[model samples]
Target: MQTPPSRAPNADQIDLRQVFGTLRRYAPWLLLTPALAAGGAYLLSRQQPPVYEASASVIAVDNDAQNSLINNTLVTAPPLPQGAVEQVMHSRSVLNSVVGRLQKTDLDPALVRGIARDLTEELADNAFTRFKVRARLDPQQRGVYELRARAETPQAAQRLAEAGVESLIAWDNNRAKQGVIRSRQSLQEQLADLTARIAATPPSSLERQSLIAARGQVLQNLSQMAVLETAASGTLVLVAEPVAPRAPVSPRPLRNAALAGLLALFLSAAGALLSDSLRRRVNGPEDLLPLGLPLLGQLPLLRRKNLGQGFVAASHSGPLYESVGFLRINVQSLLQEGKHRRLVVSSAYPGEGKSSVTAALAESLGASGLRVLVVDADLRRPTQLKVWSPDRLATHPLPGTDPALPPATTVSEMFLRPEAAHATRVSPHVDLLPAGTPARGGLPGILNQATFRALLDRWAQGYDYVLIDSPPMLSLPDTLAVAPSTDGVLLVVEGAKTRLADVERTLENARVANVRVLGIVVNKLARVGSAYYSYGYGSEQASPPANPNLRATRV
Candidate 1:
């Protein structure tokens, strides 16, 4: 026999279909997170107090008289850089003056008191830390500055902005008058020294006469310096006055809510991806492709109420029945050319519905006019009796068996006494040998390799196909022990509940035991879109008649 080609490993790669499946499962949580975040942001924004802003504009230029004095080399002073205008406006002196003006006002007394206290404390710690009054220069027009102030009310904001402008102007004027004031002080000192020297000298000396002449020149220079000082005006000129604003600049609820919603959405998507990676499980058929096992069929998840009945293929007639029919066809095709007759059905763990799948497959095969036999091999926990109701079994005993003698009822009793064993008909063409009574303590001691294989050969001769329902392979050694005797094993896995690691471990155990795995049957899948099995026929309609031309082939 030729082996199937090996597929490349895709454990490290991400599948988009799997990602979409994960997102669909957690759709409600993803939608709820962003809404809650946006609502929280909106409420927080509304709680904040409103703040009003008012601005005043000014222009900086050189004082005409002072510029002339420096040009003529009569006074030496460094020119103020354009960039320093902002620094000057925010200086401690200017802010202190603004604070003083606020104290004298009667408008918004509570606001005035708060501003006065905060500014005083902030300035003492660091001059640059004070931010009540802000200064910014116009980028397009050089030497043009805008002074802004923020307060609790419109009237207080306007008052603070106007005070800041006046204080800056006064400071600039004082800086310009420094040169003239210094020159005047020097002339007055010279005049006073000449007078003292004349008083101290003899009444008629040439030195006194020269000193008197110098004193008159010094006094005349002092008078001219005073006139120059009076002519000097400040460089700063007011361009726009502050006015009360109509709207507040802060507490924008809509914009804040929008920003919060976007941030929350990104975080939720990333979290979903990370969580799916950590807790990876089977979501669809694509998740099983990495195991390198040929897929047999996919069965839709049945309602909880139908699970207790257990035989979905016989009792239900919608998607489950159609899907079982497809599974039966695939199994017959695989075993048609080989000498394989008996097969063991099992899963990685218990409660995966492996027993139910066995009962349904047997019923479907029997419906095709082939005699099928189902043996419940799981002695510890038998479920076939529950699946096929006890009342449905035929009362007639097997042919050629003595009616007066007692027949072996359970699989364990059959293994002990093969000659006395007998089978009971469950359906028209199907027979069931249930695991009569569950073994106490552990597995029955009669399950020997040679005895179990001999009994299977005897039971399989009367039927075309034999299905043995074994226990979970990973949980106990009974499945693996009985698996080597069967032709092959059928692996059953539940959708969205079985983990990938568990499936891999189960496959490894089967390989080590030298068991042939037929294929994987993904069961209990959620019917969503084309990912799961769905038939167009409605459940209310009668079952479609089977085609008479189709013939059952045997190996």
Candidate 2:
């Protein structure tokens, strides 16, 4: 048989089947992780106390507006620089005033969110406080500031906002009065000096007259300064009064839970994909398609209840029966055109159920009315006898070959003395040659001898087909040694357990040994959906009679 060209590994290629298979395999974790995260977030959110917010808006008036409020002649303080309203609101002086006003209020302490012995100390030391300020420019190009405060109760939040507005207004008023107060003090001192000078000099003296006239002008200016001081008010004007909010602004449990769930879902999916990529296990038949080998059969994972009965007996009914029947048909079709009756069955690793698969295939082939012989080639670990029932062993032993030769009881003895070797019928049309005990350290040399091939050739004449149950290819060289004497090697791969790299390495080893690989048998595949393993007919349904038209025709 001409082997197909080997496929080069593509690093950038993505197999969607493998990706979906991995997700299906870990569906429970992917679903549970996000749900757990969302539930945790909601519970934590519920534990947090609600925070109520109230905001008050203050606008900065221009110098023109301030002058209109007071006398035009009065000197008003300079207009506040742009974007300085927030800084001034949060300034130590303004905040201290705010804290003092809050303390003098008759509000209950229990209503406040975080109250300390000293309100000033609490305001200064606490990194996260109830008070906050934001400044912005109004449409008129005037500076507007929004004073915001948060507390446990709506009434407390409103009180704090109102106190902030009152404090800022007081600070601005004091600032506006400073210039007028200083002017009045300077005028008063000049008037007092003029009176003292007039008393010391003669009434008719020119110097005294000049001083008297100057003192009258100072008196007039002082009177105007007095008026300005009483009329002057701060440039800051309260635009919007704070109101107690109906609802709290924070501790949104539903929104927080939703966000947390979405974040966790993304992370869990990424973790699953990364883990699957790193594991590199065979997920399905698509994983083996790159090897350029025909997939002869796929057996679903056996249920735990049916496992104790073993695969051979389990193959009599259920999905396993139909699957094994199909496998037997494929094997017969492949072997019909060529003289490939003798085949070695093995896997990449132990515990992959290669021995069970060999027994199952033998039983299936025998059911088709063909004589099948199962040879236990693994001398180190023989399992064919155990796989079959004890009563089935030596039920119909072959007659003695030559009267002069002693009959061989085991395969090891047959290699030593070929004339004595004989097969015992284990089932109808099925025989087993179990691997018997041999001297330690003597089996390897015995397998390598020419008599081993001669024994297989002689066995082929009596049986229609010989299935050699060999050891794992990667673990021991015994299978590789026995493979060359057979027609071809049948590789068994356990789905989701065997690594793809290990299977590739096994194929590479077979190539090096110059053994022809017939095909792959995917075993223990996970039963995912109804499409693959579940048949519409139940086990209790009557099986249709075998069709005579269905025959293993040669291609």
Candidate 3:
């Protein structure tokens, strides 16, 4: 007996049965959305365009006089000259310039955003987040440097690769020349000043000496600048050119779409479970009421029943009529062989359709050809007489019920009225008893005597079946006092509104008085999934159902 969602702790741990049950319960539309989403994903996957990518390599070296190519120490060490080139290759300036060369148009914002996201993701994932520049391990190619990049289309892949290599080389050279140009031009101006000063003044004059000293200082600076420039220029070298890519690095259409679909599914699943906490929706039987008793029978909503030769009534055709009929038949059959000729039908409370059910039961039994006496024993208020009318009451019939049976009290003795009686004849084979005069001693006063016992015993003797209509058990002592006279009781419980505690109490009262409860009759039952009548339809139920067709068969 696993507790269902409404009482289960934490929606995340919903019972598997509950999840599936909810799905099945809401199968029409709730199940449709996920199916459509998955199908759409699969369809989109098939239509995806293909892409290819290719890669090219470039090598960089140290521009030092100590080595023509970048030495192992210089290349591997920090602050190497080619480190700047690596930086330039991965820079926004470099990547933007490369994209410009590709001439992309009609861009999708989503695709562009994803490309930018994945580019950073790939670079970081490949261990390139921090600025890293190192020389090759092989002695043969000691001066090489590597940079990685990706693009959506193959042509874009190729152009990006070529653009990165070209950008690195050009930026490196341009940076080197800017410093040399400034240094050499300044030196030339200084030398000219020196010459002018020497010519204008007497030889070895003060001005000329100062000009000459300045000129020497400018020339020394130029020499140092030139050395630095030359070293910087030689440091970078290309070992290979970028090739036209055979595949695209982006879009990963299959994987990305699958992830999107999976996320949708997971969120949908979690939401379906958690929605209950937010809404407090009822989702299962445990939420409505407890269940476990063997199902007696499910009665459908009846609109009408059979119209026979002065035998059937108008109430027989409706849903309640059919339900009650089937229920009465089931209850009568359940009695032990030759026992329970008398039965008390009542519910935990009023408005459970108990009044109408009593009428339907009488009609159903009489239609079955059983000589059933329908007794209205609710002396507080009578209903059976209205349904079964134009019949007169008679003296209590118990003491004369059967000579062989122990003598029971008579109605006259119970009510202390000589005129107290057992029943009335509503039809040729069926008898009816009104709740009788409500003024004839309040409910308990009528039930606390021989009249009640005599009515049950004599009715059982005169008819093949005896059905006593009583008030709500808890509402009055009517049902409790009358229940003991019958073989057993059928507690009619209305689903959804009826609580387990109330039902237990009803049985408890019957038990306290030593009444034998035959079985329970659950009414107002709907199909498990919905209000649809899916079960017991079209199939040949072994016995004829208490239906209008009355394809009669013994239960």
Candidate 4:
């Protein structure tokens, strides 16, 4: 029958309930990554160093000079005016001379050389890491050019700026002297040519006088030029001196710390997300697959030691018993359909808690005043009678000992024990059918064809639900022989522990045997305060921050 379609809720109209659902899904991830990033940023900010910067400037002037040695335009390039100051400030020639001066003056030669080399390297790196330097054109300032340097300490920064100024002056002085010598040599050559022209012939008085006066004027001009050169030579005026800086420019502690924290959080979040995505396995029933058919039941995880006792009635006060009762309720609810009044409990692999589920489920059903028959259909390992019977009959005599039975080692005789009571002695509401002693030959033909069918026919009307527990489908032919005769089969899945491929094969085997597969019962559902031996708190601990909106059934 078709149902009428309903109107969908608009996004803006969503209530707090829907918002909470979204939060629950992402809460675990939200808490993980940001924390990591913050920690990383904190460590980075704490480990950084503080820095200080100092600056000094110089001006290059080509003022009018009486002693113009070389044509100013020919000798000097357009003062990259800005670039030349910096080049002159830390020029190798200047630093080398300073190194030599420090040695001669008995100053710490090592210290001077070290400072020079260090400052040179520091300035070589771009401005962003060091100090910003600019050439401000100001006539009122000591020098029109500037040199700025930054270092680890205030003293170092100041010293660097001061040394750069001295070095630049020394370089300019040497350059000026070289210019003077070149000019002197050129003047001497021109004088010799004039002298030769005058001595080669009888020169008139006017011509001689004119030459002498011209020579004196030229000599006067040369002497004046020499005086100007001496005065103006090396001193680049100091416009501004080094003073304590107002703020330390380096190790922006707050900003650095913030950035470090952000980076740490980003990486941490990425890691957590990656791990969660890769690790999540379909572990629960609904998570495994949609419960399309009737959910025949689920069994709580059976502990290794619990295999010693079969009865897990609500009468037993321990948590083990409580969990068992819970399993019973779930099973009873699953059988509400009431199709064939009987169920075959089976697991894909051995030791998947099937036997315990069978016994507990039977106890649960029996408590409701409904007759529940528990049969041990596992021929290879008949555990029901051994677990349910105080006599320990299956272990002690092991069934095929009838003297009249005639050495029945095969499964048909061994699989049945006529001496056992139809009802369980320990559990009145539940009945047990032990796998009898080995009969003549083995299994497949004799046991499945005659012995099992007869037992089912005799017990058909005896109980409300005949819960036949069998061996794993892969373990033996016991389950196959019994599947066709049962109402439905309950496939048990161990969460996380059971692989998908194994479960698929188990389902395939049930289909091949023509069993009415009811549905799967996924066990070991995630729980709070539950611990396991193999998985530590890391693997087994339930991350409580799961979607608070969607919750699991408490029972």
Candidate 5:
């Protein structure tokens, strides 16, 4: 499993399939997070108050009508440009005036001011709304402007637009009236001085005539100014009146939901990619691609609630049973080509489900009428014997049996004396050799002895299949030393817990011993999709409930 010396690093390749497979494995979270985010946005959007929009059109009018008429409408400088008018329409001063006018309605003034305050705050906080309320120049006509406004109600929106035009007109009228009043006062003062000068000049002098002519012109201009003030209304003329809208224009749920969904999707995809990058453990078959090992089978995870009851094949239904059957089938095919009958079960580390897989596989084979001998070779921490012979003698002797410290009582006694060691028959076709106790020389000394090899050979010739449950390959050297003597090694990998690098190291160790790894068995798989959810999707036998109590029926 070690990387080939000639091959480049794994980073050099872009494995999109593996990336997508990781995403698929975590699809529920990837889909749920985005859905929740979008749902929250939708709920928030729906809580917002509705908005009504209205527009009013206005045109710039010449305030100096009399001067224009006397001069035959000569070209004059324009009062304000379209850009300046747009700014004025949305200016705080103009909006304040509009708010004041709206507050003076026959309706409750407090309610009007409250809505106006909220709108003002919204416009101040949101740049979009600020620009939306501004005036726009008409494309078809020059010196024409469209003032738009938004409010909580149709009447308020219409009144706000109308108030913008009124404010402009009022401001222009005040400016014109002040200018006329100033001109009239100056003219009257000049007229009084000229008349006094004429009276003081006596007779008819050139200075008196010139003064009189200036005074008469001033008097005429004052009369024209007075008439101009009375004739013209204001500098701005209302071209279009604002009308109440039939429908509100805000709180657009559809648009808001779509935008929220897109945002959620972007964030969710980013999180998924980040998680995939940080993942270190193997989760499924795709994770085994780089290891170059054939996946023999996948056993569903036996939850803690389902454990402590022994081998998984006891119920003989569901995915665990089906997986054991498949493993046996693959082993049978390999054996048809003269493969070894002694299969050693080992894993990368302890608690990787190797012991459970060995017990279940042996049980499945035995049920098929094949004689199977399960040996607990893991001297460091043996488990097979405990599962098969729960009531087997550990320290006490069985009644009616040879009490002279029976020679073939346990596997440890058999290692010291193969001629006396006997296999305990658990079922009709299944037998077990428990690793009752370690010898004084320990596991290495025991497995390396000539007696242990001779006993294994003798059992290989007798039993149809010899399954040895060895200690974790990475944790101990017992499995590697005994693997060469066995037919093949079945590496067990726990899903989502076994690191790929650790499995690779374990396989490398096996390869160094020149042992053949039959295949890998991914154990403790979670039921996610249809492929793993159904126990017998295509089988003729109906699938039974999981964890059914065993009735000890004959196979």
Candidate 6:
């Protein structure tokens, strides 16, 4: 048969099962936040306006050809320059006209539902100009300028693009006409003056020849300017007309929802795991492994209020009874070789089920026909009397029942004393020594007395086993004071409630006091699964007393 695991778990070792179990335990919280986040993202997406885009292109005049035809004069300038095209397209006056035209169109209510009214007012005043329109030269075709516009609806975007294209053409034509007309008027005046000056000079004179040549050159220049002025009103021509887009470019609900949900899930799980790690509480056997003690047994969570009462009185014959029996066997196996029959049951704090476990253990041992004496050593807050009623003790005739019972050693004589008058036999083979009313001397005074150790020795000589119920180690020094004389200490840890640091501190205290720790009893396991309820160490068959002979040896 394989022995129980002797060494504690490595504190640094990672266990995948532990991770799964933690996730299972906190599944509700993990699921809730991510769902909420995803829902919120989807709703926010729905509230946003959809954006549509449309593009238009225009042909720009070649600067080199236009300038050469105009004789490169400052007055006869090129009709269009690439650098100035973008600036003129987005200029304040040009954009204002486009915005005014857009505001007049009947925009669809469903497309721009939330902000349509505000958008109309802002566009009329040219206030919503950010990224609404852009102008740039086409990369594939030189001298071709492209106009792009975005709006709440496809029709609105198309209209904005067309308006920008038309506005730039109108501005370019008006500017070109003014410059050409002014240059032509100035040249006509100069040509008339040269004609008058040549008429006044004689045909044979040197000045007369110079005047005629200048006049001829002026007329030739006038002819060229007149031809250039009538060529075209504007340098730019339409290449591609703006069309309504097929789809909106933004407000992707599915993608946003999925990303938000994943982010929320990661944050929630991380926070829960971090909090659990920092607390480091004993949740089950997995946590208790760090204590380096044999897991004698794991007790199920008991619902009965009087679990501290005798197991026989409670009529509990389920796994709880079997588990208690299991603990008794392992404890016997450990102590059978030594003369130390005393066992101290305690925990790190009050309400850890230490008192109830002590009572049940004694009752389980007695059921196997062993003479067991249970002492309530927690004088500060005694509970054994409430557990095993003192009234039950009165019903049993201690010495009258046993034929070989020592006459001088009555139950009352052995337990009833000036300090403890309430001790009595509550059941057959089992006795109770209640911690009576608080004495004039406190718990420290009572446990520290020489009589306490002497009394323990006398009881050991008479009873097969002596189980003492003591106060929590951290709560009071009573258990520590009584630990040195006991055979061994059994620490009781409540699952998911008792902190690991408290258990370690209690163990260190026992160590300093020279008390041998037998093992650990994990109580209040919340799981109702078969793994927690079933016994794993030994045969399911309940064994009879290995030694039926009940005579106690004198020390």
lDDT winner among the candidates?
A: 2
RMSD for each model, in Å, please? 7.9, 8.2, 14.0, 12.7, 9.6, 10.3
Candidate 3, superposed: residue stretches over 4 Å from native: 1-13, 24-32, 38-153, 172-186, 203-224, 233-241, 249-253, 274-555
Candidate 5: stretches off by over 4 Å: 1-20, 58-82, 115-131, 134-146, 169-209, 226-240, 253-258, 280-555
Across residues 1-555, which tens digit of lDDT does each residue of candidate 2 receive? 212212423659875666787788788998999899999999999999998999999887775644554447555556666656666665778777776777777678555324433345644675435667777876555778788988777887888889888988888888889988888898888888888988999989999889888988998998888888887777778999999999989899899999999999889989988987787887667677889888787777887778655556666667777666667877887788544388899999988888888888888888778889899888888888777754434533343345356667578877777667777666676788888763456675556667788767876775778999988999888888878887888889998778899999999999998988889888887653225346533252533332222221111
What range of 10 consecutive residues in model 2 has the weakest lDDT sum? Answer: 546-555
Q: Tens-digit lDDT track for model 6 on 333-436?
A: 87886554889999999988887788778877887788887888887777776666544344222322332443222222334342222236765677777676
**Model 5, range 1-555, lDDT digits (tens) per residue?**
221111222767865655666678777877887778778878988899898888887777564557656543222234665466656655677667767776676546766777567658856865435224344445422466677777778887787777767876676566556656677788889888888988898566888888888888988987887775565344467888989999878788767877888887777777877765675777666778788777777777766544545554342555566667777887776666443388899999998888878877887787787888888888767777666544433332222234464556566777666555666666556677888775445544577566687777765655788899988989878787788887789999987778788888888888888988988888876642224335454243643332232323211
What TM-score would each prediction reach against the true structure? 0.63, 0.61, 0.41, 0.45, 0.54, 0.54
lDDT by residue (1-555, candidate 1, tens digit) is 111222433889876766777777778878888889999999999999988889888776544354765544333223455556667656678778888888787777788878777667766766543244334444433366777878888888888888878888778777778989988888888888899999998879999898889999998888778777876556578999999999988778888898888888778877987887687787667777788877776777777555443453333467777667667887887778644378789999998889888877887888888888888988888888777664434533443445566787678766666666778666677788888788875436444577777667767776888899988989887787887887789999987778888899999999998888988888887753232334454253655343232221110
Cα deviation at 363, candidate 3, in Å, is: 18
Task: Report every candidate's CA lDDT.
Answer: 0.73, 0.76, 0.55, 0.56, 0.69, 0.69
Candidate 1 differs from the real structure by a C-alpha RMSD in angstroms, to one decimal, of: 7.9
Residue 182 in model 6: shift from native, Å? 17
Leading candidate by TM-score: 1
CA lDDT, candidate 5, residue 490: 91
**Candidate 4 local lDDT, 433-485, one digit each (tens):** 55566333465343367566665656545567888878887767767777777
Candidate 1 lDDT score relative to the true structure: 0.73
Better of 1 and 2 by lDDT: 2
In model 6, pairs of residues that clash are none
Each candidate's clash count: 0, 1, 24, 22, 0, 0
Q: Which ten residues in a row have the lowest lDDT in candidate 1?
A: 546-555
